[model samples]
Target: MAYARRLWEGYRELLASEEAYDPFLLLEAVEEWPVFVRALRRAASKNPAEALRLAKEVWREEVPLRVLGVRLPATKEAFLAQVGLA
Candidate 1:
């Protein structure tokens, strides 16, 4: 799980160079959003305040988008539920 988190972090770093790309579009392109959701869930369970801050950072509008260009997935609510915050 730690490794997965590190991998997600690396992916986020890569996104820094993809400023022309929509964050959601870029995230789905690489299929790292779900990994991020899972990691955020875990992080939320351990730290509520920090998790909330991170959530706001990642989901500024909290809008749901198609996952992998197919399915609309509500990852923020799902993560909140997983962390007992919903």
Candidate 2:
């Protein structure tokens, strides 16, 4: 989990920088975890903008773990319910 957090921080930093970032690097950092990749894809499919916002919140530890524990490959309804949006 610490390693994942560090990767997320690095990814965030790259995005914040003025220089162009590598998509492959970001993919490598994130795509190694199939569960996370699935959850992210699901979130993005539902709402791209919100998914990006949530990614930032996740890195900041602003989102509660309970909300995040909706289960990997979660149904849209399940995801919404855990986040109190259903």
TM-score winner among the candidates? 1
Q: Which tens-of-lDDT digit does each residue in 20-85 have in candidate 1?
A: 656675655457556666676777678767777665554443342232242323676764575445
lDDT score at residue 41, model 1, on the 0-100 scale? 72
Local distance difference test values of all predictions, in order: 0.55, 0.48
Residue 51 of model 2 has an lDDT of 61
Tell me the number of clashing residue pairs for each predicted model: 0, 0
- Kindly state the number of residue pairs that clash in model 1: 0
Off by over 4 Å in 1: 1-30, 61-79, 82-84
**Candidate 2 minimal-lDDT segment of 10 residues:** 64-73
Assess candidate 2 and give its TM-score to the true structure.
0.33
Name the candidate that leads on lDDT: 1
- Put down candidate 2 lDDT per residue, 1-86, tens digits, no spaces: 33334544654564456765466755564454445445655666667666655554553432322232322223545544443334
Worst 10 residues of 1 by lDDT: 64-73
